[model samples]
Target: MENTEFRVELVRLVDESYPVVVGRDLEGSVAEFLADKHPDRRAAVITDSNVASLAAEGLLSSFGSRPADLVVFPAGEASKTREVKERVEDELIARGFGRDTVIVALGGGVVTDLAGFVAATFTRGVPYVSLTTTLLGAADAAIGGKTAVDTPAATNLIGAFHQPAAVFIDLDRWLTLSDRQIREGLGETVKHACIADAVFFEALEDAFVERGLSPAEFVRDDALAELTARRNCEIKRDFVTSDVHEGNRRMGLNLGHTIGRALETAAGYTLNHGECVAIGLALQSRLGERLGYCSPSDVARIEALLRAIGLPTKIPEEVPVDRIMEAMAHDKKGKAGAIRFVFQDGVGRLVVHDGGSYARPVAAEDVHAFLQSQV
Candidate 1:
């Protein structure tokens, strides 16, 4: 029998690697960065109503002689919907924006997600940059190429893998974040540490304890904040580079996101994403212990770190467990009503399930039992 043979040439779909500028006072560099990276593109700064007057203004001012426009939507998670994406896209069309337009996401996770979806779909796809304002945006949302808007059914259910032209992390922007917003960012930072870097987790813990700072206060500390932002980006970069399309290996990055997204959807946009993720991490870590994949001490340690940062560890009494489970069943990671959960073997490591998938189908009964324990 002749072996099947075919010549395969490697074709690179994405030719350029964008820079992630992480530092204080990086606002001055935005225009220069755009000039260097996308000199001919028209700029469309997409921000939320809350951020329009804050970091958004600074970003627009930095545009210098470059042609740019601002599109601000109502602030909050409720705005991260298909309706909002369409509205922004319509604004771009009405303004005569073309394929050469560059979308600048100028707020937290929601803005990035919505504006990114718009960029991803506009004229098929367009270049975009993230000028992250909130800590959550800096640490996670703005880094990975993953972009999406929420649907009535689930969080980020409809989206695309549209890489940004660049990502700007201006540390000074975080000063304007509320304490709750700071905690929201810490949620992703903690997940990054738990999934891949024990040392990072310890560093964050030590920083909080040594300085005697609450989670919110700790996020405001210059030294710790910078380190956290840089480290989280590095960890995410490793995952994204290893598996740009999520395939299997990158699914490890979804450690707590499986259940976390469910909680966010069930809460109806009330619980900020990072807050819901903190709860998901705590519950999943506990589940890992129950399944004998990790030690009870592991669960306790994770919960303690999250609590230290003022993140909630338990399911809110008001959020329905059944609703969460239903949402989990419909999660993008799941298939045919089966829920795929990513569990940790220990801090800084994910447990590879028997089939070698980073995601495992856990029994609904087991998940229900765990939720009951949480309350």
Candidate 2:
């Protein structure tokens, strides 16, 4: 996309009272956006070591007159935990971070989630801005007010709904991703398309033809990718707007996240979240097809898109289907011994399983069948 022509509007959710600014290279513009609200002489940035060298310099440079401190954590999903969150909090406190101080997160989903949680808890909530560096972070994780860290028992069971003051997405950072990383991010985008827009889904099919292209290459000429991101953001924004606390509407965004989270935990936090979601989405689609909620063609298209993006459409070979099902039973969405799921009736239409009304409750047999079909 031509840098001059590409424009990302600032979306402000009145309910959450947070503004989302989307644009290429918006990371460089963070200082200006937070200048008025942040009069504190010093700010602390929490980011992973992997991204610190790449993103930290530009962000620090943007601070200019304002002093910025850097706290670097080890990269990967495993780093998102209570221990990590406490360490970050201590760093913030040692730096004399007052209520006026801002916490800037510069990395992928894990960084944003951990740092944002720390920001929320520190001094009973200080302002923070999400400078997302990955596709999943940009399109989903960073937008919503959800911030969390994992526990030994479950993923994201410990967290808070803390909205950032602003979100800055730099499309330029995406250029640094490997093919595998890009494909992982595409999983979230695909989920958004499947749940919200059919056109966006088709657009992703075209972009992933050659194992994903650079942001500039794809976003510049491919209007669809840009549109898909925007549309996906809108879907999430509306959901959060209605249920900022994830009381109702926000549950829709958890379409495949229930099973996805379980898979991540089962993998001992070794798998990327988007990769797990890709598998979860496929499993859900297969279940939907078997239950007659979605057609076989729809399931095929979903799996094909995931594969084209280099995502694993099936569960990992190491994980047993029964274990995955057992984990699913403990999902956050499950209620009163019944597991609930968000299944699609068709493109852009989702129905939450409500105590086996029209939708039959998926049993262990069905899950095993779905798993077998995928392998």
Q: How many clashing pairs per prediction, in order?
A: 0, 1
Top candidate, metric TM-score: 1
lDDT of 1 by residue, 1-375 (tens): 999999899987756578888888886788898898789999999999988987776777888888899999999878999898889999999999998999889888889988888989999999898888888888888777889988877668899988888888888888878889888888999999998899998897786544558755665678887888898899999888878877888888888888898998888768988898999899889888888877988888898888878889988899989998888777667666457788887898888877788888877777887887788
TM per prediction: 0.89, 0.85
Model 2 lDDT per residue over 186-290, tens place:
778888887777877777777765446444466454355457557767878877777666565566777677679888867766788889999888888888787
Error of 2 at 311 (Å): 1.4
Compute the lDDT for candidate 2. 0.77
Residue-level error in angstroms, candidate 2, position 352: 6.0
**Candidate 2 clash pair list:** 1-220
lDDT of the candidates, in the order given: 0.85, 0.77
Query: Which residue pairs come into collision in candidate 1?
Result: none
